[model samples]
Target: MQPVVHLAVGYLCYAAYTRLHHGREPADLPALVAVFAAGLADLIDKPLDAAGVVPVGRTIGHSLLFVIPLVLLVWIVASRRDRRLLGVAFAIGYLSHVATDIPWHVFSGDFDELGFLLWPVTEMPAYTGVKPLGTVAGIEITTLWLEAVILVAAVACWWMDGRPGVGLFRPSHRA
Candidate 1:
């Protein structure tokens, strides 16, 4: 999935979680953290692959082996700090990212694409092609439309949720 889609889905997940669990819009810090966590896998893996430090773009960071432990550590630390919701938000975002990357292949019965989830225990399939970045020629029109729809939904939900995270960017009123 595209970064924007990942972020949108992450926010949607966070919004749903907060609404279901707390009966309100998502809080600012958790919302921001969830969005950042949504991109964290690509941020870790893409740079490593680009630098030739890793053989594939979806290996280590995309692995359940890595993410589960990392998220558990985050949860442990956050819980100790009395901020367990932040850990839950991170889990929602990061896990949703991993889920989005795999579901297309899973739904299509292309199990080979799922080997990355196990990392060293099961190698990632070789990169088939360069992922399209802002290019129409390399992307299917349906995917572009889907991404647009998801982004619009996310924006609409955020608006309806009263734009929870925006307050973090405003200048403080403290004298």
Candidate 2:
């Protein structure tokens, strides 16, 4: 999935989680963390792959090997800080990113593309020449439409949530 799609889906997931768990709009800090975490995989992988530090774009960052321990650590630390929701938000974002990448290959029965999930245990598949910011494999038109729908839904949901995290970027007015 594209970065924007990942971000929108992450926010949508977090927003729904907050509504279910807290019965309110997402809190600012957790929402922000979720958004950042949504892009964290690509942020880590793409740079290393582009720099030739890793053989493939999805290796460690896309692996359950990495994310499981990382999420657990985050959960432990956040629990100690009494901010477990932050950890949950991060997990939702990160896991959602990995999840979003799976369905295309699954539907097409191209399981090898998912070898990245196991990392060194399974060889990283050869690069498919699909640009990260460009078209997805196999179903470009459907993916584009899906991304558009997700973006629209995310914006509508955020608006309904009273645009919760937007305040984090603006200076607060204190009298």
Candidate 3:
């Protein structure tokens, strides 16, 4: 999925999860943080390769082994403060990104290519078939549908939130 779509989907997921579990929406700043953080793995991979470092793309960030521990560590350290909300928000976004990639991998007939989900336990060449790299124009119907869903969710969430402007950066003032 595209970076913007990942962010949109992450926002929708965090909003829905918080609303359902806590009977309240996540704060705007944390919600936005979650959206960006959701795509952090994909964003980090490219630079790692260019720097002559181990190709971490699709390997380290996408790994459940890595994500789970990272999220857990944040959750644990933030257990005493409101920062826990931020941790949960980040986790929601990160995990949702991982979940959304499954169908893309499967549709691309590269289900086995998702060794990154396993991380250190498995080693395989990270496939780039589903991503638009170079002249490849890697496009798929599943990805299109997912993007549409993200758009719709973003619009719906905006409407539900009263279409706030700067208010989106703050927690809801409502009880």
Candidate 4:
């Protein structure tokens, strides 16, 4: 559940950041910026997670209402089209995370060890005990996995976007 949620959010954030701020072409600033924003969101998660029911790291923070309105505000204030795209994609991707993550985890396996994905209806991870660690752990399983996922997604996006001279998170290479 944590894996799916964060991975999707990270990829979406990267997509939004890359498309919106960095330009549909390529740039590193937005990727790093989104990572920073996600980190900040994680920090906010510490105080916002409410038994993962009302909302948690991937629920509210990753929610469309939260991420979209936020990006819209930035788009309005900064007049950044790229950032706006990122915001939109970020919102969609984040929500998609929940859509794919929660329901699947909730109904996937035995979930005896992890079932908070259902929330309200069923709880097995003991709330705080399964309260996601990647955002906080930084290099732990959740973070590492999400990092890889987002990296792959971003690179794939760049490739598919038809931009040239870019390898991945790195700058363009004409050589």
Q: Pick the candidate with the highest lDDT.
A: 1
Instruction: Report the backbone clash tally of model 2.
Output: 0
**In candidate 2, what are the lDDT values of residues 1-175, reduced to their tens digit?**
6788889889999998988888889988888888889889999999999999989898888999998999899989999999988989999989988888887666556678889898978988875533223345764455557678998999899888878788888998999
Clashing pairs in 2: none
For model 4, give the 10-residue run with minimal summed lDDT: 126-135
The candidate, 2 or 4, that scores higher on TM-score is 2
Best by TM-score: 2
lDDT of model number 4: 0.46
Q: How many clashes show up per model? A: 0, 0, 0, 3
Residue range 81-158, candidate 1, lDDT tens digits? 999999999999999899888765654456787888999799788754323233467754544466789899999999
lDDT of 1: 0.86
Per-residue lDDT, model 3, residue 87, is 80
Model 4 C-alpha lDDT per residue in residues 20-99, reported as the tens digit of each score: 66566434444434434544434444455655544434334534445566656655654455455444444444444434
Query: Which residue pairs in candidate 3 have backbone atoms (N, alpha carbon, C) closer than 3 angstroms, thus clashing?
Result: none
**Against the correct fold, how does model 3 do in TM-score?**
0.76
Q: Which 10 successive residues of model 2 have the least lDDT summed? A: 127-136
The 10-residue segment with the lowest total lDDT in model 1: 127-136
